[model samples]
Target: MIMQVKNKYVYRSKISEAKFRQIVRLFALDLDATQISQIVGLSRVTINRYLMAIRERIAKFCESESPFQGDIEVEYEVDESYFGPKRVKGKRGRGAGNKTIVFGLIKRNGKVYTEIVPDCSKSTLQSIIRGKVDTNSVIYSDKWHGYDGLVDLGYGKHYRVDHGKDEFVNGKSHINGIEGFWGFSKIRMSKHRGINKKYFYLYLKECEFRYNFRDENLYLLILKIVRINPLFLS
Candidate 1:
């Protein structure tokens, strides 16, 4: 029950490639493991396994395109969202419990890059910004204290939207795109009821991949990604 897409990487499975692809298609359609299991006639455990492998490959692909996409003046929006037990609403402080902090940077009209950070501190966020964003690119963000000092740090093109004062947009300087993505991610993730902390990174990356390529045929895109970067290394 092994299916090898390329010579080196192997996808060990009892199902045929077509069946596996059907499973993948279901997964791309955002069906949970239970739904895919029922349609594909596979056990939930088996379905979850394949899905995890697929997600691993997707995460790898997303990482390979890091520092955001396009070298030109692709305006970037940066934000941090908290995924906790009850809601997705923490900013600077992590509060308590299994509150996971995820930072994201999205190129305007392009792909999004995400990272799970220790905190929404200035240093933690700025390090990622300094690495991912170009000094010349225009950046947009809400006036979170974590996003402070970007202008002093050489990202002079940075713009801020004061959500505290209810100012979301100022000319073209708004973080509505990234903020919309946060809402999208939260809504989709809530369908799972609860996600385990250990596997949360993979899930977050999956969300990023889906949102970044929301307009494309995800099944084909995933297949292309897996084809290029095999899930299992020989």
Candidate 2:
């Protein structure tokens, strides 16, 4: 039995590893609570119970530090992706909307560090860079005016590909990896319409987790899941 904060109640179930796997698979496939309940022949209340357990479990997965330290390889890219809400019909430039800003740092080879940010201001983006990246690494990004000041933050190398002038590359200066990630993320979100903003970060964390560890064995993955949060099991 477990108590979930969002849904007021305690639920008891003899859920197994296989059942948990099905739950995740269905979730990744974008099935909602009603659909998942019907597919699993479980009550809506029971399905929500399992989903809460899964969320709490995945939150624990982030406790372990990612293996990458400092700059990744010889090149790295940083970018921001906005989601949740859009500018009203015609308005633009950070006007009031429900949008959430997310920051990402990706190695040329595809490793990434992602986070939910309150806004895309220079200070906010710099804080993330300071925490996750080494100052000695070369950073690549589009010619966003805010990022122009990163050199003052001690980044030894900075490169910009001016998208405004079609200068995407001069050699190794492009943000393609991170751009592709944002595209994939937006596409995934679009397929599901819109996600509840409160739960948006959780979904982003899951995507990064899956993208970074796509090659592990099924049993090993299950072990990782168990380790992610055994509190729910307890």
Candidate 3:
């Protein structure tokens, strides 16, 4: 159930390299494990195992890659979203139960970075922003009080869109890019019905990878990452 390649062991559970690559290709195409199992003629359990392996590899690859840094002269959007089961009939936003908080930053026509945070408090969010974003970057976000002190935190400029007033954009300020990412991630995850909370961070990183490489050959890109980080399979 293992194969050694270039002196490194690559896990293979009775799945040939060709078939494994096929499964990965289907995965890149956004097929659910069940759908891929039907096409590849593999059992759903086997397919799901392969997916978990791939997702773990993706998580390692993303961790090896450095966080966003340097000055961002161009505009960038920052936002936070909650991910989890839908609320039955409770208050929305902040106090909703069964929700996981995620913070994200995306540059206009550039890459994106996301993380599962403990909370959306100003201190928590500000620390992350200071580390990942440049000190003088132009940032755009909704009127979330957590992001209120960003201007004083050394950003070149900070703009807010009052979503409470039904305003989503102003002359040159909006979080449409990051918000679009949230929608994209939610829709994609919906196909899986639901993901386990324990592995949600890995799935979240996969979403980040997908969005960051949206303009490139995702299949080849994934293969490249795996090839470079072959030890991730262990």
TM-score of each: 0.87, 0.79, 0.90
Q: Please, what are the lDDT tens digits per residue for candidate 1 over residues 1-234?
A: 455342322344356667877877899999999999999898998888888888888888878865454475669999988886864455334434558888988888877888999888899999998888888889999988988889998887888889889998999999888888889888888998888888888889898989988899999998778767655522
Residues 120-148, model 3: lDDT tens digits: 89998889888888876788999889998
Overall lDDT per candidate, in order of appearance: 0.82, 0.70, 0.81
RMSD of 1: 3.4
RMSD of each predicted structure: 3.4, 4.7, 2.6
Q: TM-score ranking from best to worst?
A: 3, 1, 2
**Number of backbone collisions per candidate:** 0, 0, 0
Q: Write the per-residue lDDT of candidate 2 for residues 1-234, one digit (tens) a residue.
A: 444432111123355546656766786565777899888877988777666666555555754656366444356799987786766676666424657888898877757778887787888888887777777778999988768788888886999998889887778889988988888778766765778877877678666765666564533563457544443433
Regions of candidate 3 where Cα sits further than 4 Å from its true position: 1-9, 231-234
- Deviation (Å) of 124 in candidate 2: 1.3
Clashing pairs in 1: none
